[model samples]
Target: MNIIALEALTFGLGRLAAASRKHGCSLTLFTRDKTVYDYELSLLDEQNIKVVEIDTFDDHAVVEMIRNEKDVVALLSSTDTWSLHCLDVSKSLGLPAQNADAVRIARDKYQLRNRLYEAGLSSAKSQLVDPRKFDNESVIKDISYPCIVKDTAGTGSQNVWIAYDKEDLLQTLDKAAQEVLRGQIAIEPFFSGTLYSLETLSWKGETRVIALTSRITSQEPYFREEAFSSPVTINHSISAALEVWIDNVLKSIGYGNGFAHTEFMITDTGFEVIEINPRLGGVQIGEALCQSLDINIYEAWIEMALNKRPALMDVPLNIHKGIGQLIIYATETGEFSHIEGLDRLSAHPGSPRFYPTAYSGKSISTIVDQRASIGILLAEGETSEVALLNVFAARNKIRVVMKG
Candidate 1:
């Protein structure tokens, strides 16, 4: 049997491939651009995974190709861009799938906010703004100052802005008006606190909080992710509280199966919902989880596709060492040259390893978001805190040299 992935995260293909083999299936990935997986593909063999180049956005073409394939057991997708499309294809093929309506709500930021607010799970409500017919006065009146403005379906922090005052809000809205958006523009009150993600798994309405991943982002107004560490240490009381709260949040959205990378803030009031991704956390998060938990986390993805309980649910989470990942960004936008100070990594504590996201000669036009990131530097330590410190120290030695 074969397991089909519509599209996957930049990392974790090898783990997914191995997991598929463990379940007696070969992994086939359908993607429009194979080069996106260059770093991951270089590490794998054909027997473990096969990559088929196709315009995955063409729904009819993908469905036809799946029909022609032999012995297809399950279809899956773990990307924000392809999640809904994958669900549609699965439904058309009479394959097991998550609730389409639920996934729809999860994908739209406005809808998700409203749903949570109506369910009494969210403190702030979101207001949808039509960028073309934007009324700055009305939006300000509804949401007030110190609010967040973002594309309802934005990803990778591409179209997110924080408007602290009138001028900032107007400028942000005007900027948003000039750009094409994936969904409607949404404005919500900004919550001030540290940000973290709950890596969770759900099966048949039951959920498990696998681990907590701490996030560090670029300074105010620009929310580019800078680093991450998994298995954050929290007291038992807070951990239990988060588990219950996340369970309530997921249940409100009708998300009953699959992995959820749920981002939130622990404000002075309580836990507030940021966004929920119905997939594994991206950017070497799978690697961090694997190292911290000492298990191949992707196996759960295969199990869920087959409509069976995720084996990870029953496995005891024996945390080994904490893992931290730092995103290496170019200081200036230009043609990718090479990363300097690689040799120095060997001298750094925590056994730091670098994973390149961009290759030499690739044009880099921006250094404001994930686009500017050239590679990731990962390391391990005795605890998540120490791991984070180790990765940051290692990251300090590296520089992304770009040719102007």
Candidate 2:
């Protein structure tokens, strides 16, 4: 069968496409630039597959090309525009769509929150207040303390702020009010506690929790996500509770068809829902977790997308002693400086070190949410603290020199 896989971000979709080819399937990749095309070409070449490029998703010609591709059985996407493009193109053709309407709800935080609220799902009680309608001070008072101000539809924590006080809240509000911030922001109570993310697969009217990953964030105020690892290296009871909640959550959204990555918080009061994304998380943690635990999630996704019932691997969820993922960050955005302890980083007490693409003195920007991950440091140990120490030791070694 021939498949069209959207290649917009480094979402490990390319690998999924390649796996399709390895299993005697052909894939047509959609790309807009030579840089992305060349990168995808190199990777696809390894699997002996050629890519067909669509320079723009906005063109009618592109849509026609997608509609007319011979034997085009499925189309997969992970771009911000994927929900819009895939829905338009897939419907034009006679292909499957995960959730055309749900895609919009999942992509837009405002709509997502409203939907979740309407469904009576556990979430931070939020309001979508347009500043032009009311005063910022009144909005702050209306919500719970330690609230988060976030862009309605943004990724990688680009414009997310956790307001601590009135002044900071006002500043953040004003900054969000600029010309680029036409959409509304979420003023929700900041639910405190341990945060966890769950990946659920919906197939054949039977939804199951594929993997539960625990995300570790930077020490608050900045709220940058550092890293995430699978099996949630936490209590079994906690994971089980999450499983039950996740299953119901998707079923509520009418998602017994495809993928959903939902974030949640386990607090002393109870478990509250964080936002859920319709696509896979960008860190490629699902594949990483599968590798660490002897499971192949990407291949399974491909198999199911092609109408073939792919059996889920029996990944021993809690068998992991201590698996940890570390997100590397530049001290400042500048030219490539020097890494301090390469020997120490390479010589982790646990497993392997996944050094990101950044090298000494490479020019980098000073914004680290998810995309700013210079590299990933992973190591499994007897204890999470040991794993954390091992990761920190490696991260501390990298000395970056940004352009001044």
Candidate 3:
């Protein structure tokens, strides 16, 4: 089978490349020249993955290229910006795909919230404010205090802020307005609880949930993720309740064939949707899921693209050990000179897998969003606690040296 992957920035590129090689399938990657970094280009070169550059904004050009691929069996992308394009191209080429409108509903936070609210499903009370014309007095009266203000189309927690009072709320809006587009910013009454991710793979509207991951984020007000571990030990009833709720959400959105990564909170009131990403989790979450469950979701995704329901291996419900991913963010502002910790962490018993995004002489800053993340660390152990301990211990051993 021949598969064309759009937008190589997503972590899925490497995984998809591996899966293609394993399945004896050919893969081609399409990337926008301006958006992809030099290092990413080199990695694609080393992997012998073909890279084709085109203007992503040119819809006619994109459609022409998709139509030109003679033996293309599937068109896929794990990026938010290019998702609708991929789906539309696939639909034009007569391939199986999710509803374009449904995917938009999943990607747009305000739409998702309103849809859930209309359906009587649990969701945060949110209001949208025009960033350009946002007035504190009028907006404040509309929304409750202690709510979160976020860019309506923001991702990776780049433009998300929490406001505990009126002053904080005004300040947050002032900062967020500069980052978001002209559209309204979403302000929602905060829901407090433990956060978890529910991952699913769907085939023709039949959803099969594969993993339930427990997430740890930086302390209140910011949504920057610190770590994630899976096979989260939840009681059967709680798991069942969450799964049922997620299924209803997916059904309501008309989620068809593809992967859905939904993050929700287990609150005192009930389960509230955080965001429903219509793609695989970024970072090493996919890798963590593979390690924890011993199932290759990327391969399954490819198989599903070929109109075959992948026979996912039946992983035992009770996993003795936990598999986790820890992200290391830059703590200083300067040019990244070098790092001292890989050898130490590698030699340790943790069996860590490290992916360093910052190279020597690269500019670094205090991480406020996922883009500022400098590296990632992966570890596993006999228990969730043990796994987390190893991860933190290894992180403590490393020092990210920066040049002032």
Candidate 4:
């Protein structure tokens, strides 16, 4: 069987291939670059990274191409364009993108809200807008006050802003609009509460939640993720609302199969759906979960994509507690200069939770959208505070020198 991966996010392709091989299945990688593709092929050629040769996402032609192929399987996408083409073209071939209609919920936040509204679900009351008129005070009043704003397509949080008052709201409109390439955007009430993610796997019509973990983000106004952990280590009763919301959310989004990474807020108002990504949770959270629980979610994801649900997934929950991850965000942008404490941090007792993601010489971006421009410091621990401090400790130990 061929496993077609989308992008190499630090380590996506390797993890998928390792897991697939462990499950006794052969795999191939589909890369966007001919050179990098060939380069990886040279490295993992022994491990089965075959470059996916395709020109465009023409639905019919792709269907014909894969019709005679071996057990070929692909999953939901991450990179914007490739992800869409994967869904549009692959589902046309009875492959993974089964929840084709649900792709939009991930692509456009407004689409997510609309489907939630129709389903009588509670969420940040939001609506779509043209970037040109987004600053109009009238439009601000349209959503009421103290709302959040960001580009529709995805500035990756470039100009995303949270307005506590009308003035801040109007002031951010222009900057925020400029960040969106689509000139379209979304505005919603700023979420207030603890945020968490339920990175789960769903079979045909049935939802199987393996991890209900909490997420740490850049002190939001622009809520880009910084780190994540497996198993929130909380009782199901405490997260009962989340469990209900998850089941309803999958049904509402029309997701009958595949993996889903959902972001939500647990507030006094209840579990409010923030947004959902119909793919594996990044930061190797899924891999971490697999390590802690002895299950290969990535492999299970591949199986479902190929129209087969491996029986090993039913090997009982075995997961007794939740895990946590903390992402230490950078305060400045510059090439990483010197580093310290990774060895000591790694040596600390009770399983060290610190990891620095910056590689000296890479410039970082301080803006929320540019937050990732700085790279991440990862940590995992039993409690949120432990995890958070681990991330902080790692960040404190590292330094980056900007080329001035």
Candidate 5:
């Protein structure tokens, strides 16, 4: 079997590539030529994963190359741009794939919010504003205070801003205009709650929740994720209600195939759908799920895409261990020096998994979103509390030193 992955340099890409090898499938990775390619080549070499350079998604030559690739069973991508490209190519080739409209709705925050409102799946009030017309008082009047301004199709929380009052909102709008934001931007009332994500696999509208994760984000007004703990077991009643809500949201959004990383805000009143990402949850969520569930989700996704069959993994009735993931970000702007407490962190009893993404001697600035992540740390323990504690301890022990 053969699978084609586009822009496949995500943190989980290595594991996915390993899984493909283990499953006796040949993997071909297609990525654009860029400076980042330098960092990716070594990882690809380490995995023995094949890499193909493409200037564009569907240039005649690239399409010809894709068509000639033998025994192509499925297409995989973790990034938004290439995932949509995969969908387009899948459509062109008459392969099983997600609907283009579904992918669009999943990627565009404004479309997602509008569709949810139209389908009565959403309760939050939101508006799509033209960045050029952001200065109009009439347009800004409708948006309530304590709202969030976000790019329509952005990922990793880029160009996201929180407004606590009208002054802040106006200032944020000015910033957006100066940034020359692309497409329409969304403004929605910010909800205060505990954030959670449902990692699900859907096949022809039949979806199964694979793992439930609880998230910790940087203290707002910047909402970059800081930590995550997976296979979270909520109370039975809450879990049942959330399951129903997630099912309705997924069905309403027209998610029929592949993985959907659905995020939600659970509060005392109820739950509100945040955004439905049409890819696997990035960072170490995949790693945590693999550890807690004892299954390779990427490999399962490949098999499901090719065979159109449900993936049945050997999930124990009770998952006793908790896997926690922490993303370490730069606290100050300066040249990168070195990380502290590597030896102590590694030798800790929890046996945490660590991978630093930043290079020494490279410059780093304050992290406002997921893109600024310097490194990732994972720790597993007997329970969620223990895992979280160990992860927190490890994170505190390991500090990213910035040169003066």
Candidate 6:
């Protein structure tokens, strides 16, 4: 049997390929650009993993390709960009899949906020704004100052803006008007607090919190994800409360199966919903889960795709260690050069491993968001806090060189 992926995250392709083989299936990935997975592909064996270059965004082309495949058992997509499209294709072929309507709502931030607010799960409600047509009067009347402006279907923090005052809001609106957005612009109250994500797995409506990751972002105006650490430690009572809250959040959205990466904030009042992704967390989050829980988490993706219950749902999760990942970004936009101080990682305490996301001779642009990231450094320690510190120490030694 063969398991096909519409597209996948930048990392974890190797593990997914291995998981498919473990389940007696070969993996075929359809993507417009194969270079996006260069880091993962370099480490994977080609015998069981196949990468086909095509316009994945072309629905007709993707469906036709899948139709021609032999013994296709499952269709999988663990990305924000293609999860909904993957669902449609899977359903058309009578393959097992999640609720398409639920995925749709989850992918739209404007809709997701309203759903959560209507369910009384969130204190803030979102307003949809046309970037080109929206006026300051209407925006100020609907949302108060210090609100957030972002693409309803954005990923990787590509178009997020924080408007602290009237001038800032107007400037942001003007800036947004000039850019191409993946979805409608959404304006909502900004919730201030520490940012965290809950990595979860659900089977038949039952959700389990696998691990908690702390999201560290760059300084204000640009929410570039700088670093992440998994299995964050929290008080027993708060952790219990979050478990209940997340279950309710997922239930409200009708998310029944697969992995969910729910980002939320612990505000002074209570926990607030940021957004929920209906797939595995991106970057090295899957790797972090595997290292902390000591299991092949991607195997669960294969299991779920085949309509079988994930064994991970039943296994006892005893976190052995903490995992930290730091995104390495270039200081300027230009031609990519070599990364400096990688040789010093071997002397670090956490056994740091460097994964390059960009290669030499590639053109680099936009240093604001995840687009600027060239690589990621991962490390481990006794706890998530220590792991973060260790990764930071390793990061301090590395410098991304760019020639403009």
Report the C-alpha lDDT of model 1 over 218-284, residue by residue, as the tens digit.
9987999999998998989999999999999999999998899999999899999999999999889
Assess each prediction's global lDDT (C-alpha) against the native: 0.91, 0.66, 0.75, 0.62, 0.76, 0.90
Candidate 2's residue-wise lDDT over 275-376, tens digit each? 777766656565555555555567766777777665653334444444567776776655655545556655557765664445455556655565455656
Candidate 4 local lDDT, 1-404, one digit each (tens) = 56555544443455567667775666654444444333334446464555566553454655565565587656435445455677766656666465567766666777777778778886445677676664465576656667877665553445467888767776776666555364367787776788888877778778777777667667756666666655666766876756667888889888867677777887887777777777666665765677567666566755665567845447675663334454544455554454444566565423544333444564565645434443444455555446555555555555544555
Deviation (Å) of 397 in candidate 5: 2.0
In the predicted model 3, the residue pairs found to clash are none
**Model 2 vs truth, CA RMSD:** 3.4
Q: In model 4, which runs have C-alpha deviations exceeding 4 angstroms?
A: 22-24, 33-45, 51-81, 91-96, 133-137, 155-159, 310-313, 320-324, 328-330, 336-341, 350-360, 365-367, 370-391
Residue ranges of candidate 5 with Cα displaced over 4 Å: 33-48, 56-61, 180-182, 313-320
Question: Candidates 3 and 4: which is better by TM-score?
Answer: 3
RMSD values for the candidates in order, in angstroms, are 1.1, 3.4, 2.7, 4.0, 2.6, 1.1
Clashes of 6: 0
Candidate 3 residue spans exceeding 4 A from truth: 22-24, 33-48, 91-94, 180-183, 313-320
lDDT string, candidate 5, 269-345, tens digits = 78888888898887778777777767666776666666746454333425758888888888877787878878777
- Model 6, 1-404: lDDT tens digits are 99999999999998899899899989999999999898888888789698888899887888889989889988999999998789878877888888888899999999999999999999979998887886668777856778999999999989999999888888898899998899999988899899999999999999999999999999997889999998898999999999999999999999988899998999999998888999999989999989898999999999887788999999999989999999998888789889988999999999999988888877878899988888999999999999999999999998888765
- What does candidate 2 score on TM? 0.85
Provide TM-scores for the models. Answer: 0.98, 0.85, 0.90, 0.82, 0.91, 0.98
